[model samples]
Target chain A: MTEVTLSNVVKRYGKQQAVHGIDLDIQDGEFLVLVGPSGCGKSTTLRMIAGLEDISDGEISIGNRVVNDLPPRERNISMVFQNYALYPHMTVRENLGFTLQIAKQPEAQITRAVNEAAGILGLDELMDRKPAELSGGQRQRVAMGRAIVRQPDVFLFDEPLSNLDAKLRTQMRVEIKKLHQRVGNTIIYVTHDQVEAMTLADRIVLMRDGHIVQVGTPLELFNTPVNTFAATFIGSPPMNLADGVVSDAGTIVLRDSLTIPVPKSARAHVKPGQKVQLGFRADNLMPVGHAVEEKGELVDLELTVALTEPLGTETLLFADLAGLEVQAKMLNPRPVQPGEKLAFHLMLDKTHVFDAASGVALRG
Target chain B: MRRRIPEWFVLLLPAFIVIAAVVLIPLIFSLYSSFTPYKLTRPSTLWRWIGTANYEKILTDVKFWSAFGRTILFLTIALNVELLLGLLIALMVNKVTWGQRTLRTILMFPMMFSPILVGFQFKFIFNDNIGLVNNALQSLGVSNAALPWLVDGNLAMFSIIFAEVWMSTSVFAILILAGLFAIPQDPLEAAKVDGCTPWQTFRHITLPFLMPFIFIAMTIRSLDVARAYDIVQIMTGGGPAGRTELLWTLMSRTGYVDARMGLANAMGYVSILLSIAFTVYFFKKLSAARAELGMGG
Candidate 1:
C-alpha cells in the first residue's frame, strides 16, 4: 500500500482551469472519497492520478516517490473505470491474467493468480465465458477482478458502481469496502453521491468548482462545516437555511418577521441589526406537541405540510415553514396531513449560524 | 373452402416476381444452355441436346485448363499482395494525427477511378516502344535495348496482375479502415495500462478484432477479382496468344467471338463454384473470429 500526495496540483484545459491548484495528503491505506457536483474536476483529478490526464502544474508523489513524469503502468497503479472497460475479446480468465501474461509471468503462476482472484470475485463459474455472455453485475465483478489481480500499490475506482441497479449498487458498495479491507490497499474513489462518499471514505474531500471546499472525516464535516456549501452538501434532506437578522429585542428575527432568542454561544459572532442565516439539520427539528416547549428556543410557526414520507422507522414531513419549504424528521408517527398547518420546536443549541453575505459558518 | 390471401404476401409478391424474372429465370436458362448446343445466332439449335460433350471438351482442353489454373494463381497472388499493402496503408493512416481526413479521402481516390481507366494508364506506362517507360529508359541510357513489357508471356501476365492489384488495393484499405474506426478506445487504453508494447497491442488486440472486416473485404474482392474483365480487355484483350487470358476473357471469346454459347455457359457454371468456395471459406473464418472475441456464437 502507498500514500498519495498532491502538492499544488493544477490541471488546465487551454485557458479554462479544470482543476485549480489543490493540495491533499492521503495517508497510507486510507480510503479517501472525493465528492463533488458535476464540473467539479473530481474525475479529472482521479485521471491525473491514474496518468490518464496530464498535470498542468505542481507534483504528485506516490509512496514518497515523485511520479509526475511517469506513465500509468510505470506508476504501478490499477484503475477501475465507471464503464468497466473489460477486454471484450477475452474470457474472464484471460482478462484477469492479462497483466501477468504481459509481465512474462509463468503460465502456472498466471493460472493460479487468476483462479484465486476469480474465486474471490465469485466468478469461478464464468472463467471461460466472454464479457458479452455475462450480466451487468458480472461485468462489474470482472472489472474488479482485473484490478485486484494486478496487486498494484493503489486502486483507483472512478464511479464503478454508478452503472448498477439501485439494489446492486448497495450490494457492490459493501463488496468494494470488504475488498479494500481484505487487500488493505489505498483506494481513492470518486462519486457524486454524498451517502457513498460519507459511508465509504475514511476521509472525505468535498470539492466544488474545481477547488477543495473542505477536507475532513465524515463526522467532522457533518458536525462542523466550514461554509454553507459544505453544510448543505454532506447530508440527505440537506440543511435548512433561513434568512434572519439579529434584533434590538435581544433575539434573531426570521424572514417571516417572527423573533426567537439567539443562542448565548453565538453572541460574540453576531451584532445587533446584522443580517444572518440560521441553519439546522432536519433531525434537530422536533414536532411541537412531542417536545417540551420551555426547554429550548421554541418557535410556533404555521407550517403547511406539503407531503409526508413514512419510512417505517420514522416519518419525514415536507412542509412550508414561514413561506420557505423545509423537511423535519419525526420519530413518533403523526397524522400530519398535506396542506395543513403544524407546529415545531427548533433546537437553537443544535443550530448553525452563517454570515449572510460571505456564506461562512460563524464560530460559536 | 374460401381462401383469403395474406396482405404480407401481396407486398412481397412484387419483389418475388421481379427477382424471378431478373435472376432465377436467367440462371435456369443458363443452366439449360450448358447442356445444349445453343448459339446466340442459331435459335433452333437450342432444342438440340448434347450430353456431356461441352463439359468433356472443356475438361480435356489443355489451354482451357491452363487458363483456369492461371486465373487461380493470379487471384491468390493479387489478393494477398493487395491485403498486405492495404493493411500497411491503414496502419500508417491510423497513426496520422494531422490531416487524417484528407489522407483518407486521397487514399480513396484510386477506388473512384474505373478499373478500365487504370488498365489504360498502366498499359501506356508499360508499353515497349514509343511508350513512356521505353522512352524514359532510353533517355536515361540505363538500357541500350528496349524491354518487351507486354509481348512476353511472363511480362504480360505480370503487367495485367500489377494493374489489377493497383486498382483494388484501396478497396481493402477503405473497408479495413472502417473496421479500425469502429474498434472501441477502451481496449487500447487497457492494453497500454497492462504494459503491452505497441506491436503487442496491435497483434493481440487490434488485428484479431480486424480479421472479420478483412475477410469480408476478401470475399467481396474475390468475387470481383474472379470476374475481372474490363481492365484485362482494355489492356490486352486477352491477346498476344492468350498469355494473360483469365476466365472472363476466355469465356467472352468462346461465347460472343467464337459463337460457342454452350461452352461459355459451361465455363460460367464452373467459375461460380470457385466464387462460392471462397465466399464460404471467408464466412467461416469470420464466425470463428467473432466467437474467439466473445462477441457472439
Candidate 2:
C-alpha cells in the first residue's frame, strides 16, 4: 500500500482545460472518493492518477515516487473502468491471472492467486465462464477481481458500480467497502452519485468546474458546506434555498412581511439591507407537533401545505413559506390536505446563510 | 377449388430462366464436355465420349502438376505476404491522427488499378536491359550486369508475386482497418492497466479481435489469387520455358490457344477444388476466432 499525492495537478485537452491545478493527498489504505456532477473533471482526475491520461502540469507521486513519465504498468496501479472491462476472450480464471502472467509469475503461484481472488469475490463457480456469459454484477466482480489479484500499491475505481441496477449498485457498494477493509489498499474512486460518495468515502472531495469546492467527511459536508453548491450537492432532496434581505434589526426579511431572526452564530456576517440566500435541509424544518426546544433559534412560520409525500416513517411536505416554495419534513405526520396552513419551526442552528451574489457561506 | 401457383414463384420465374441460361447451362455443359475429347476446331468431336481420358492424362502430366504446384505456391505466398504487409499498413494508418481520411483514400490507390494494367507496369519495370530497375542499378554503381528479372525462374516468380501483392495488399489493410475501428477502447485500457506492454497488448487483445476480419480478407483474396490469370498472362505468359506457369495460364493456353477445350475443362474442375478448400479453411478459422471472442458459433 502507498500514499498518492497530486501536487497542482492539471489536465488539458488542446486549449480547453478539463481539470485545473488541484491538490489532493490520499493516505495509504484510505478510501477517498472524488464526487461531482457531469463535466466536473472527477473522472479526468482519476484517469490522470491511473496514468491513462497524461497530466498537462504538475506532479503525481505514488509511494513518494514521481510517476509522470512512467507508463501505467510501471506505476504499479490497477484501474477498474466504469464499464467492466473484462477481457472478452478470456475466462474469469484467465482474466484474474492476466497481470500475474504478464509479470511472469510461476504457474502454481498464478493459479493460487486467481483462486484466492475468486474466493474473495465468491466467483469460484464462475471461473470457467467468459465475461460475455456472466451477468452484469458478475462481470463487475470479475473486474474487481482482476484488480485485486494484481496486489497493486494503489487501486483506482472509475465509477465501477455505475452500470449495475440500483439494488445491485447498493450491494456492490457494500462489497467494495468490505474489500477495502480486508485488503487495505489505497483506493481513489470517482462517482457522480452523491450517495455513493457519502456511503463509501473516508474523505470526499467535491468538485465543480474543475475546482474542488469542499474536502471533508460526509457529515462535515452535510452539516456545514462552504458554499451553496456543496450544501445542495451533498444531500439528497437537496437543501432548500430562498432569497432574503437583512432587515435593520438583524433579521432576514423574506418576500413581504415575513421575517426570521438571524442565528447568533451568523449575526456578525450580516449587515442591514444586505442581500443573502437562506438555506436549510428538509429535515431541519419540523412541523408544529414535532418541534422541539433546541438551544439555537426556533422561529415559527405559518406555511400553506402545497403537497405531501408519505415515505413510510415520515412525510416530506412541500409548502410555500412567505411566497417561497420550501420543503419540510413531518415526523409522525397525519394526512394533511393541500392549501392547509400549518405552523412549522425553522431550526436556525441548522440553517445556512450565503451571500446572494457570491454564494459563499456566512457561518463560521 | 383449383390449386394456384405461388405468386412469389411467378415473380421469380424470370430470374430463374436467366440463371439457367447464363449459369446453369454453362456449368452443366462444361461438366458434360469434360468427359469428351471436344476440340474447338472439330465440332463433331464433342460427341466422342472420352470417359476420363483427359483427366487421366492431366493426372499423369508433369507439366500440369508443376503448374498446379506453382499456383498453390503463388497463392500461399501472395496471401501470407499481403496479410502481413496489410497488417503493418493498417496499424500505421490507425495511429495517424491528422489527415487520416486523406491517408485512407491514398492507401486504396494501388487497388484501383486494373490487374492487367498492373501487370504491364511491372513487366516493363522488370525488363532485362532497358528496365527502370536495371538502369537504376547500373547508374547507382550497384551492379554492371543487367538483371534478368523476367528471365530467371526465382526472379520471375518474385516479380509476379510482387505485382500481385502490391495490387491487393490494400484489400487486407482496408478491411483490417475497419476492424480496428470497431474495437472498443476499454479492453485496450484494461490490458494496459493489467500490466501488458504495447506489443503484448496487441498480441493478446487487438490481434485476437481482428482475427475474424483478417480471415475474411484472406478468404476473398485467396479465391482471387487462385485464379491468377490476367497478371501472369500479361507479365510472363507462362514463358521462359514455363518457369512461372500458374494453373490458369496453363489451362488458358490449353483451352484457347491449343484449342483442346476438353483438357482445359478437366483442369478447370480440378482447380475449383483449390478454391473450395481455401474458402472452407478460412471460414472455419473465422468461426473459431469468433467463438473465442464469445460471439455466435
Highest lDDT among the candidates is held by which one? 2
TM-score, second chain, candidate 1: 0.93
Regions more than 4 Å wrong, model 1: A248-251, A260-267, A271-274, A288-302, B1-13, B130-147, B152-155
Residues A198-281, candidate 1: write the lDDT tens digits: 889999999999999999999999988888999899998899988899887768888677776776667788888888888888
Tens digit of per-residue lDDT, candidate 1, span B1-297: 979899999999999999999999999998898999889889888889997788998889887888788888888999999999999999889889899999999998888998889989988988997668788998999987877888888888888888888888988899889989988877776776676778878987899889888988999998999888988898888877988888999999999998889889998988788889888988898888888877674
Score chain A of each prediction against the true chain A by TM-score and list the results.
0.95, 0.97
Model 2 Cα lDDT, one tens digit per residue, A1-364: 5999999999999999999999999999999999999999999999888889999999999999999988899989888988998889999999999999999999999999999999999999999999989999999999999999999999999999999999999999999999999999999999999999999999999999999999999999999899999988999889999899999998998887788888777899989998999999998898978644444678888889999998868899999987888899988879989999898888988888999999999976
Deviating ranges (above 4 Å) for candidate 2: A290-295, B1-3
User: What is the CA-based DockQ of model 2?
Assistant: 0.81
Alpha carbon lDDT at A186, candidate 1: 94
The Cα local distance difference test for each model comes to 0.87, 0.93
For each candidate, what's the DockQ? 0.56, 0.81
* Model 1: lDDT of residue A317: 87
Cα-based TM-score, every candidate: 0.92, 0.97
What are the candidates' interface root-mean-square deviations? 1.5, 0.7
Point to the candidate with the largest TM-score.
Answer: 2
